[model samples]
Structure formats: C-alpha cells, structure tokens
Target: MAMTPKELLNQLMQTEGAMCAALVDYNSGMLLESVGSGMDLELAAAGNTEVVRAKMKTMKSLGMQGTIEDILITLTHQYHIIRPVEKHDGLFIYYVLDRSRANLAMARRKVLEAESQTAI
Candidate 1:
C-alpha cells in the first residue's frame, strides 16, 4: 500500500532527532500536511517558499541547468532540510532536526527514501 502524507511524515519523525516535518507547496506557501510541534509550521512553510523561490531565481539568472535536489540550512542547534519532491512540481518536504541528536547523513538518506515512497 502507498503511504499517506501523514504516514510519511510520521516516518520522518522516527529519525533520531527529528523535531518537525511538513509537506509544503512552494508556489502558494501552503502546508499540505505536518507533524510534530513547537515551531509554527505554517510560518515556516511560507518563509521557506521564499527561500526556494529565491534560490530558483538565482539559479536561473546564473544559467544553471539542473534542478535542486535539496537545500540544507544548518543552525546552531538545528538542521533544516528542504527537499523538492521529484514527482510533484512546486511541492517539497521540510524537516527540522536537533543537531546534537540527528545524523545528517542518515536523515538525508531517509528523506530520499520517503520521497521515493511518497505519491503526492
């Protein structure tokens, strides 16, 4: 059976240091689904949308040819990962992790697996 959006996010949260996870629509800055707490996911989704748009615009201006696989924003205490869903345009997965408890490499791999397994 195909995993639902919530199920996929729940899987991401099972990662050692996951703080929050969400599926977002970059074009409209909408949160399609989310899990975990503390942070304002709606605000994060909207803000990240601008981040994605800016990066894409910069890439276009620089004449870059390839699509963005992921964008990592490392904070003092957290690691924010933004991965565009290959099968869905203008949609992406956003996950926040506790730096001290999360394995970045493993989290990245998990994200890839989740993306592949996700249908929308």
Candidate 2:
C-alpha cells in the first residue's frame, strides 16, 4: 500500500537513531508533515530548504548532470539527511538521526523506499 504523509513520518521514526523527520516542499519551504523525538521540525524544515537550494545552485553553476541522490550533514552528535523525492521532482525528505546509532547506508535505503511510496 502507498504510505500516507503521517505513515511515512511514523516509518521514519521507527528507523534506528532517528531524531526527527519531515516532508518538505523546497519550492515553497513548507513542511507537509513531520514526526519524531526531540527537535523543532518546523524550523528544521525551513532551514534545510535553504540547504537544498544552495547545493542545487552550486551544482548548476558547476554544470553537473543528473540529480542529487541525497545530502548528508554530519554534525558531532547527529546526522542530517536530505533526500529529494524523485517521483515528485521538487519535494524532499529531511531526517535527523543520532550519529552514534544510525546506519547511514540503511537509513538512506529506507528513505528511498519511503520516497517511492509517497504520493507527493
């Protein structure tokens, strides 16, 4: 079955070390929905939109081809992942996970899986 926005949020929370996650529209800087533990999801969603925009601009300036698979920001205590929704084109999923507990590869795969089932 396809996942609803809330169901996708819940799936993200189930991932090991997940702190927070949100579905964001980079074009409008709006969070469609969110879920997780300690974190201000609204602010994070807005900030990450900027992050995605900057990277995209840089890539364009450099004449890069294809699309971004994901952006990973490794903080001392947390890992922030920004995975763009390929199906929707301009939408994205932002996730924050505890670095010590997260499996980066697995988390990335899971996010991709979630993206595949998302409506928009």
Candidate 3:
C-alpha cells in the first residue's frame, strides 16, 4: 500500500539498528516530519541540507551530469543516509543506523524501498 511521509519514516525505523528518520526540505533546511530519538533531527535537517547543496554545487562545477541517488556518511558508531525524493523537488529522506547491529546493505535496500513508497 501507498504510505504517507510519516508512515514511510516509521517503516524505515523498523530496519535493524534504525535510530531515527526524517523527511526534510533541502530548499528550506526544514524538518517536515521525523521519528525516533537521540539526535536532534531539526538541526540535522539544516546541516544535511548544506551537505546536499555543496555536493550539488560541486557536481555542477565538475560538469557532471547525473542525479544524486543518495549520500552516505559513515561514522565511528553510526551510518547516516541521505536520499533525495524522486518526485518531490528539494525534498529528501534522512536515516540513521547503529553500525554494529545494522546490516548496511539491507538498510540501504529498505531505505530505497521506503523512498519508493513514500508520498512526500
């Protein structure tokens, strides 16, 4: 079934080791919706917005011609994922997972599934 933005996030959180998830507007650096705890998703949304913007700018500067499917940030204890929503311009998904317990490949697959099912 089709899922609302929040429902999609909830589904994402069901992934093993999932910590938090949010739907963000990259254009405005705003958190449209979020779930879970530990990290401050509001601030994360704003910061990651810049991350997306900088990458986009760099891509243009290099004259690269392809869309960003997703951005991955690996930390000592966590894995962060940023995925741009296909149908919604300037919108994206942010998901965090614990490195030890999560299966990176499976988590990535689930995020892609959630991205596909999400309605922005």
Model 2 agreement with the true structure over 12-87: per-residue lDDT tens digits: 8899999898999999889888888688888888899999999999999999998999999999999999999888
Poorly placed runs, candidate 2 (over 4 Å): none
The residue-level lDDT of candidate 3 at 15 comes to 91
Q: Give the least accurate 10-residue stretch of model 2, judged by summed lDDT.
A: 36-45
- After superposing all C-alphas onto the true structure, candidate 3 shows an RMSD in angstroms of 0.7
Q: Which runs in model 1 stand beyond 4 Å of their true positions?
A: none
Q: Candidate 1 clash total?
A: 0
- Cα lDDT tens digits for candidate 1, 31-113: 99999986999999999999999999999999999999999999999999999999999999999999999999999999999
Instruction: Give the runs in model 3 whose Cα sits over 4 Å from its true position.
Output: none
Relative to the true structure, how large is the alpha-carbon lDDT of every model?
0.96, 0.89, 0.94
Clashing pairs in 2: none
* Candidate 1 accuracy as TM-score: 0.98
